[model samples]
Target: MKSLNLYIFLLLATLLGTSCENDGDRVVLSGFQEAELKATATNVVLSNENSGKLVFSLMWDAGQLQNTYSERYGISATALTTTLQFSTQNTFSEVKEVVETSSSKSYTGKALNSLALSLGLETGKAATIFIRLKSSIAANTQSLFSNVIELTVTPYEEIAFLYMPGDLSGGWDKYTTKVCSRAGNGEYEGFVEAAQWNNFKFTTEMSSTSGITYGSSPTDLYALDDSKDQWNIWFEEGGYFLIKANTNAMKWSKTAITGFYVTGEFNGWNPTVNAMTYDSAKKLWTVTCNITTTLYGIQILANGDWAMAYGDDNKNGELTLGGANIVINEPGTYTITMDLSNPEKYTYTIK
Candidate 1:
């Protein structure tokens, strides 16, 4: 009877030990839980003088590092690494990473202007900057993004001229064939004559052997090849054209002009009286007439109508609607030339 009692007591003790072991295992596993991460920032500003020295601060939850690693990998957060990433795109397509190792809840860093420039953000323009925290444990990683911040950067201007080189244009000369003007928006615009089936492209410098050249593509502009297979854009018929391009956007467009005329003080302000001749090679309109040394108004009429007329506001070069009429101080067999290819700075010379 005593042997039976001892056997039963041993069985009960074994069961209790197993239950205790299970309870301890549960406690260990439940200690780790998913971590929550967040970040905050103040205003951000960028400028030319301060671009290289730009700095910003970010504050985050203190226990995120520990909780994230513990919950995800059953490891201590001290073994994980952290980085601050700056991106122009909220999707984080392109990112610049800066290592951060602050045990405190906040971090500060500089070199923001350099990062902004690398992302192609123009100076003197405001852009939305996206920032985030990248945490990693071994090869496993995760990102926590902060609220987007808007900043304006003062960009340095790089003087560049666009040249047209082709078989029919500029005689393929790189140095003397510069025809495009760079606008404030970084676009290039000018006039060029393309012969039927003639090929041409734009270049950054006056060199056929060196410098950046933009070539034609079916969908968008492409960088030309250095050695061979350089593509040239051609037109169906030979004519004078107005070309505009935004190289950064890889976009280009062209317009063909047929004729131009002038009518105002020279012809009693009649739009149909005097017609100017178009010099296709020079891409200008020219006319010669006798006039008095009177302060008479003159206007450039296109296709002989009031539908389109251009006048100068300051009488310097810029053209605007309802602009002041041109004044001819001296009257002779004056030769007048009008260049309308550049409408923003349309000019006329009287000699």
Candidate 2:
């Protein structure tokens, strides 16, 4: 029994010594080593090959790290984040960082264009782009940067307008020409008024006779055969209409508005109190009401609500939202006519 107890005590002492040694000894984890990154191409050129769109691709090799630190630190080398640092100068003074999260080394040129615009680079001008790559290893360590590459990109000119030069309102003049705004997907829209025997056509320029001109056909759209062959779209009777044209599908549509109203201080600012009647033959909203002598403003309200309301911006017949009130200094019977069919030339007459 004495020998057995002595053996048990020795075993306990050995175990305690082993535990103390382990407590004093620190287990160090290996960290990531510097990686050498190389790009497949040193320079890239971006062009508007695909309908004013350019795509950029970068192929690279990330060097091996020492000690398998990724596995030790619960990280994957493949999962490391990659980012592109872009700048106009080689010194990288105004650097913009764009992350490339995809496994593939591809980026769209549109992104580079946006960056260029942000950097004050003008469109249609060639600009040098300096770019470098950053690869992250661990959270605590610094990221590795690849060699810089220079790229030359020429952004395309963005065109966004279609003009209507017609004799509907008057002769083909700048004041009578209607400007149509682009609505994306090769579509343009605007409002125009037409009278019987009036002729008008779509043109790229307001005053010039050059460039593309659209004319009416039995089909959706057609090019004018010659300068004299301006096939104008006409209306049997004079009326106001909204016009929408799709250049891609070669189609057009028109919508006629039936009514609108004047509701404001003259009518207690109540939309439903008094309404204006539309004269289909005249293509105008006409109303004559008694107004108070007190200072009051009027607004044109459509469908008796604030959702669609127009006020005079300069009180000079031109209508726009958030405009100055149309005030009547003296109370009397007044005649008001609103012509809203032509968005480019909206007017309200007071008498």
- Top model number, lDDT: 2
Those runs of model 2 whose alpha carbons end farther than 4 Å from true positions after fitting are: 1-177, 180-190, 193-201, 206-209, 212-239, 243-256, 277-284, 339-343
Tens-place lDDT per residue, model 2, 1-351, is 333443443354455546657667322223333323344443434444543343565665544433322233232334355667778899987676645544335444544444454455656778887877777654544677777777776654333345666676466664354544322233556656666666676654454533345667643233232123335765555665666765434455665644466666656788766678877557677888888743767877766657657788786888774567776668888998877555445788889
The residue-level lDDT of candidate 1 at 344 comes to 40
Model 2 per-residue lDDT at 82:
67
Q: Which stretches of candidate 1 lie over 4 Å from their true place?
A: 1-87, 92-153, 157-160, 168-175, 208-211, 219-230, 265-272, 279-284, 290-296, 303-308, 317-323, 329-334, 339-346
Candidate 1 per-residue lDDT over residues 220-336, each given as its tens digit: 333333122346766778876666766545567776755556666656777766678877657777888676544666777655556557678786866554677777676667777
Every model: Cα RMSD to truth: 16.5, 20.8
lDDT by candidate, in order shown = 0.55, 0.57
Evaluate candidate 2 by giving its C-alpha RMSD to the native, one decimal: 20.8
State the weakest 10-residue window (summed lDDT) of model 1. 25-34
**At residue 271, what lDDT does model 1 achieve?**
71
lDDT score, residue 44, model 2? 37
- Please give each candidate's TM-score: 0.49, 0.37
